[model samples]
Target: MKRWTHPQDFIALIVGVYALLSPLWTTTTSKATTTMVVLGALTAVLSVIELVRPDTLSIEGLTALMGVLFFISPWVMGFSDMRAMSWTAWAAGVITFVIGAADLRVTRSHRGTVATTL
Candidate 1:
């Protein structure tokens, strides 16, 4: 069996794909699409890194969390209209952030086990 569970892998894979494609479906005006695409790309890249190297997956959650927060900043801070991009951005951000937090928690909990075995 693999170190990471199937559901974890699937979720990560799906999220990574979504992040990569978000920019294509959304508007690109005023750098909005550019920013979203960049963030999504980052998430996808990091996820790939995690999949290939479980030992280095420690920061996946952090990356995801940061990406989501960055995506929602415009509306979260009252700088942009909530209906235009805020809701979608916020939804993406929250999901990514949760995934990141979960990954961080799982990675942290497993660290002790690995250490004790060493």
Candidate 2:
């Protein structure tokens, strides 16, 4: 019924889409838009991997990294002046990070259900 799969990954995917398209709703400088698009693309790509393969936690881990990057993009990209971009990055990044952490927790609790790599 598609009800028992990893919901965390699904949430990540949704968040990724939103982040990727965030530039459309907000008016920002070129740098901010570029940062948003790049970060969002990374999050989405990692999410797709998590869904199709569900391999080791590495994909989820990468997703988390992407989230972190997004959250800090405002500062790193030097576009903190744009409130919309900054806020969007923060929100999207936090959501993706939370999802990744939740997935990790779910897998850990599954009792060997999720495989790991060395």
Candidate 3:
């Protein structure tokens, strides 16, 4: 396995785990709980995949998509009134989105150089 190449992936992994376990400490509705668990797991999995295969640019895009989903989930799932949960979702979402998007940009820009050198 490739040694984790990107710091963003590590940060994403942390955010994912936090989101996954947040429901235990934070008051959350069933919908919020489910959303957190699902999105968190997906984030974690994608992060791991990226860490193992840093060249997979598509994974970064998916990670960004996950972040957007997380950001909007509180409202779409009707749990925005829960301050703790909503805030968690929004913060994690933004962090994940930014990391993913940034990584995607860096990876894409570097791709041509890598190909030309090979």
Candidate 4:
């Protein structure tokens, strides 16, 4: 088993799980539930892959993309009127995006440093 190396990935995993479970507690239409489940699963799976292989830079981009999808899901999926669900998506999406972007920056900088030193 791969060791847990990144706290950001762990947080993202939590966010994914939350998103997956949110539809149960929140008022959701069929479309909203489907969107949440699919996006949440994608986020969770990507986070796990990142946790296992932190060097996989592409995963960060994918995660950020998931965040963007999540953020816009309320409007696109027609759930924007549901204040609680909308807020949840907005908050979770922002959090996921920041984590992915920040991690991507750090990882790239580290790579640059290594390349310079080598």
**Root-mean-square deviation per candidate:** 3.2, 3.7, 1.5, 1.9
Preferred candidate (TM-score higher): 2 or 3? 3
**Model 4: worst 10 consecutive residues (lDDT sum):** 1-10
The sequence of per-residue lDDT tens digits that candidate 3 reaches over residues 7-112 is 9999999999999999999999899999999999999999999999887659989999999999999999999999999999999999999998998888887887
> How much is 101 displaced in model 1, in angstroms?
0.9
Candidate lDDT scores, in order, read 0.61, 0.79, 0.93, 0.88
Pairs in steric clash, model 2: none
Model 3 residue 65 CA deviation (Å) reads: 0.6
When summed lDDT is taken over every stretch of 10 residues in candidate 3, the lowest stretch is 1-10
Using lDDT as the measure, which candidate wins? 3
lDDT of 4 by residue, 1-118 (tens): 1448788889999999999999999998888889888888889999999998887758888888889999999999999998988998898899899988987877778789989999
* Model 1: lDDT to the true structure: 0.61
The candidates, ranked best first by lDDT, are 3, 4, 2, 1
Global fold similarity of model 4 (TM-score): 0.93
Q: What residue pairs clash in candidate 1, if any at all? A: 61-100
TM-score of each: 0.74, 0.84, 0.94, 0.93
Model 3: runs farther than 4 Å from truth?
A: none
lDDT of 3 at 32: 96
| Count of steric clashes across candidates, in order | 1, 0, 0, 0
- Report model 1's TM-score to 2 decimal places: 0.74
